[model samples]
Target: MTLHAHLTRTVARPLPITSVVIDDAFWSPRIEQGRTTTLPTQEHQLRTGGQFEALSLSWKPGDDNEPHIFWESDIAKWIEAASYSLAKRPDAELDASVDEAITLLAGAQQPDGYLNVYFTVVRPGERFTDLRDGHELYCAGHLMEAAAAHHGATGKTSLLTIARQYADLLIEQFAPGGPLEGGYDGHQEIELGLMRLAEATGDGRYRALARKMLEDRGTEPFYFEAEEQRRGTPGYFGFLFPDRAKLAERFREYNQSHAPVREQRDAVGHSVRAMYMYSAMADLAPQLDDDSMQAALAELWSSTTERKMYLTGGIGADPSIEGFAGDFDLPLHGAYAETCAAIGLVFWARRMAANTGEGRYIDVLERALFNGVLAGASAEGTHYFYGNPMLSRGDMTRNAWFGVACCPPNFARLVQSLETYAYAQTDDSAVINLYVSGAATFDFDGHALGLSVQSNYPWSGQVDVTVNTAPTVEKEIALRVPGWAQDVALRVAGEDHQVQVHEGYVRVRRTWRAGDVITLTFAIVPRITRARPEVDAAAGRVALERGPLVYCLEGVDNAGDVAQLSIGDGAALRDEWDDDLQAVRVSVDGTRHLNTSSSLYSSAKDSVEDATITAVPYYQWGNRGKSTMEIWIREDESASF
Candidate 1:
């Protein structure tokens, strides 16, 4: 019995970049900025950061610069981002740079198809000896992903060839009956990368290898512990982690290897790694027809989104381990919502949507995309936020680059690949997952169907879609009804249409038409929302949400400090536009608790004064210089003075 013997999964297929064109008021400019500004800045950073130079295997131990074990992965991500940009709009200079990078990687690959700059140049002849600490397989995974993206964009096989060779080597070294059987990378990403390679090359070997690695994980005797004993040292990161016992005590679920994955219930460990692992599991569950894996995925999805996730769709509360803490332990002032983790959530959410054909996953995807993921990078697409805190005290700001620059490139890739997330299709139906203004062409049994969507989503819920199809094609066009919206109305050609809503989508079945117009409306309005009582940090506090954007009060916008502002019950809220931001802002009536008495332990009550609070979208915070910011506002118990 083998995992690969099961039937292949049937998931929704996304339209290719060639078949979809995104021309809209909101996403068009951002997509262009991703290609023009973000990609160039990342390339320059890679050159200066020694990522491109390290591929020559020239750095020494005592040199001014040392090659990092994870440097290759950074460059690999940039390559992937650039490849996506090139696919949409070809640029000669960008193509040349990609070619140069491929040349460097090709030169560095060993005869055995193994690739890693640190192990090759910094410590030769000691490869694959530190699976617990070293990131060799992780880097290989990124390379494989970059290779698939490059091949898909340019139809070039140079990087694909190198990726296949390295993948072959990995199968030999890590597969069952291999010398190093039962081995798994400490950081998960290769699983997703292997799945990408399998799709691109039509090779089942890569997918099987991913399954084998996943199945080998969390097995007894724990390969990492045994590998540490063999090395006779704590590990590379021994100083911070000390020993396995101390590491286990401090970080309860280290890398999510505490138990067999199918038996695991909670979402724990490194936030980014956990998301990657769960994403791969969601992808493989249907293909293998494993009901247990799907159930496990559902449990984890609830544990993550229902309890651990932030209002802005951010995850990972504790900064100490860059992972999740106890349920409902979300602290607004000190949050570790890494940018990569948000992107990982988007990936997993999309896969879950494909697995179940449900609209709830898409809701999470939209939340993360609009708030958490967009907040990671600045509007200009150059500066980035490594950790997005729910509350900022004039100290949190964007940086041009970081020592570990993983978030920038990861953000770039997701922004450039936005079109694929907007729409999906099957043999007899076309699904609109996101309300982005774009045009997508789908072919069903040699008949073509074209759909053009127009709207300013996350701002207005009025989506106007025009469908064009061949005379022979008569299929269903499904539009997703957002979970947050209310009083949804749908009309076909100016006539109110009554349709059955199933699984959060309104499915319309009709004969072929050339210019059939459909109007879907959901009144977008400002509302105040509160977290569960269990979330102690947000007790008696409410957050503002308009459409999909979460609004936050910044000191620059309201008074000089937002820490004392409290929203009274039945506060009047209105939407206004900020000239500087070119986006809608929220205005509300509140009270500010004034500091009166000077005595430290005085029992005197602080005087309250009426105040008008101005709030901007959470994603746009920190862009207008650092200032005090808070998402959850204190609630005033009394409505009348």
Candidate 2:
């Protein structure tokens, strides 16, 4: 496809963040932090963690490798973050550091094109022997993703060459009829990463490669079962893996291959892996036009989102497997919504949007963004939360860092790469997927289409879009009217314009000219949301939400534990901008219900006392000192949340 055609492809594609400039109060500072603070800090962590040192030593052949099992992928994620940071705003030192790592990786590549520091330096003779538990393909997937990011941002092929070589090696081992037969990644990441590689290089074979991998899993004589049998039971296995029975059991529900991807309906196994595999399926659905794959994705998405998802748009209620347990079996304090799961949810949601071009997908994306992903990182952008919970009584808090530091880099990379998800362009139209103060310019049939947007967004409901295109370029611009918004007001150049609202977007079509403007206002008001009665954890409770954000009550703000609070039937909610939280805080008239018996199990009903309190955005909680936080408040009525 020519540049013009590709730029205006009807199918949804992310505009290069480089082409679009984002300078909003909401996102610019976060991106800057990723560039200046987060990237540098993560790079330092990777170096101190001996990720680069391990790869460099693996290349030395005789040296011992002293890094963790998944260090390569951790470093790869940091590299991915650095690549996005560099693209958004270049950093000389960070670029040099990434170059140095890439050079080390280039040297570490085996003559056979294999690249893994753990297998090479630690278990040289046993490469590809532990696909059930090993993360070799997972690391390769992260490297491919990093290479794609580096190539897209810097227009350099050095890293891409390394990734291609590694990919070829993976194909040689795992591809159909390859020497190493029936091999698949224990982790489901490589499939999605392969899709990214295909998009980066425009080689459909990578997509084919991804499809082959997904189709191969959960087949007769499952690779995971065979691997487990080959390794034998606990006492019979090798000393390196002292617990084979436990490891063997992990291959079942923990890896998400208990059944074929298409046959699986409910989300199972690792939350991150489930989302990754499903996202790859969704990404491949439109590309291959596969009906089964599409149906599988739709059913899986509905299964996860409808009954299993949290009010905060989180999944994986069970911590034992770090994944889903059963439908509507959500636990409040024991919620195990990992940061990686939320990131994978964002990935899935975006691909789903691109596949269908529907606002519902973006709605899920925004929920994960404003609540889960945003909550992963701290207000300073340095600390991270690996697990996000809906109701915490001071036990959960963001850590400075982690031994397995996936969330920090993942959060950093996502925040730095926000340009793509903000807006998208079609062949003869464009979609405003997100509301932010920024500008996006793309070519539409030999015409330069520029969209300049200004809005306070989640802070306020008003959004103003200005068009800078030739009058001859007739096109449509669809503004997303959030599902939460009703009676949306629209205007064109100061004149009230009547437009039909469909699905979730307000469509306006006309010949565009320079300085043409469109304004949209969504009514921003606080709403009380309740969960289904089946959610026992949230029975007779409610959550507060304003705009796209979900609000929670923290103990510090209310001067008491949130468990003591209850919302009246006709509560009057008020909004005020809290400088500390950096968001508009909502206060509600409520009651503090307490049992006077002082017994563990009291037969008497709790006494209700008048108490007014404020609630902050769920993402803003824990920013202050450690305190109890609760999402679901006791309802005066019988509404569950």
Candidate 3:
């Protein structure tokens, strides 16, 4: 069973959580926290934030509060997270709460199968009137995802029934000749969700709807243009269309629809919307055998990774559009690397990996997973930053919650389903994706299989795998040697052996025994990573990375003025233990630049002395209270100070 109902994944199938067990010290506790603390806290935030009351059918005509159009998606995500939790760890009370929410949400559905809380409770007559700003379909897509998750978690179809009714109603309303024809949700989610529903319940109608939604976009007598004409468009991108000269041309750029999806290349528009659409395209292309669609995804991957992405795997170069600006337009401090967008990147990358039998997809996935996605939440597992910036000046801090708090729950759901991303299985091979200590047992070609893994990753590069209860046939195990790893060594049965190393993984093909062990090690040395010169904001700056962890200097440890410091050289870095954070600290030789200029602008001077400062992992910052924080530093290009 795959996390997504991706029956068409060409290269590999992601074994469900039931097929694997996570027994590691690192992920076990993290998953437990998500189950106990994060899920409950999100529920409380939703309840206190008036989500239940907002969606309730008991609202009077004179109710003062108008529901947020997108409020239902938040509840949908919460139920999805809770459903994932209930699948692994059963809880009677939590189960009851989820069922209760499902019942109330169902009660709010309109007679026509349209299930939007805002239109039902707030504006009854104007349902689906403003599709661009309404978010009716967006909310439905998330609820459909929740329905699929609930079915997987509880093995029940109560929520799935609601989603089916919603899907049928949507199909009736938006079919080729229906009233909503030639229209798509301004947000790109329903396409992915429809595909999930089609897989969950073997109905081709949903997939048909999914394809129609994508196909109907960017055609002549444009729906966006017509909708903008009727609504007098005022939105940032999708809303105001006819207001432009070349209407169809510019809307495609904003919607990643310049041409048909298969023809579009560079990543564009709202970062999250574009990513969600791209992920669905990747999932559908192989099933339809559409090579052009796959080619578009490949082109997009190169454009985003090689130029637009940050060293920390963050995206979104422009804060105004909450999307990309141009090639190599990465800004350090002013960057709006939305957490949801980065998580969306993981979805796209994983699908890309499954489509193409390559390990470079895993490289991009691991980098984003370790840095950008992990940096969304604080250490306490509660506070979150909606937008993650590479540089923070003693002011950027996480909030308990936000008005549009999509990122928090979006991340919570991702953390709950970590098992699916850990490994992918094929007929004769099982790929080790992420190095969290876990024991996975699954059936391969009608034969029983068992494998156990141990690692102290990021902090240490050594990984040990034991072929416990081996397969009857020769099963090849491909271990991902991360792109960052250089000097990697592989050993079998305590004896050094050379293996066929491809793209970015070392493949060991052998028939194994229960006691047979394989050992692998990668040098865990701190190295400096520099930004491309085109990124003017980070021209002379460099960041430090060891293994998968990106290091950052906080003001509290560096005399409260982190900007005054410059990195001397990566070779001078040394590791030390930090009792406060309960993690390793890396310190490097540097110099504190003297602020000798009387005016704000002056000639650069080298009045400095030798100094050093400590740095913590990017994920560990803002825990000791807010202070100046920076990932990139002034690189000592000439010599060690």
**Who wins the lDDT comparison?**
1
Candidate 1 error regions (>4 Å): 1-7, 246-252, 599-601
Q: What is candidate 3's lDDT per residue for 1-641, written digit by digit as tens?
A: 11122245467777787777887766787788888888888888989988887767666667666578888899998898888888888999889989989988878877767787768766676776676667778888899989998998899999999999999988878886778877888788898889878978988788778877776665666676577677664543344444665555645576665567777778887788888888888778777644887888899999888978877677887887788879988888898989998888988888898888588888888788878898898877888998989888988889889999899899888888888888888777788888989887757867766889899776788889988788778888878888888778999888898855796678888887787888888888777888778888888888888787888999988987788888765447788667777677998888888867788888778587767778888878888888999998887766564
Q: Model 1, residue 72: what's the lDDT?
A: 90
Locate the minimum summed-lDDT window of 10 residues in model 3.
Answer: 1-10
Query: Cα RMSD to native, each candidate?
Result: 1.6, 3.7, 3.0
TM-score attained by model 3: 0.94
CA lDDT of every candidate? 0.87, 0.81, 0.81
**lDDT at 136 for candidate 1?**
86
Query: Deviation in angstroms for 555 in model 1?
Result: 1.0
* Candidate 3 wrong stretches, greater than 4 Å: 1-9, 60-62, 230-251, 569-571, 603-606
Candidate 1: residue 560 lDDT (0-100): 88
Best by TM-score: 1
Q: Order candidates by lDDT, high to low.
A: 1, 2, 3
**Candidate 1: Cα lDDT at 497:** 89
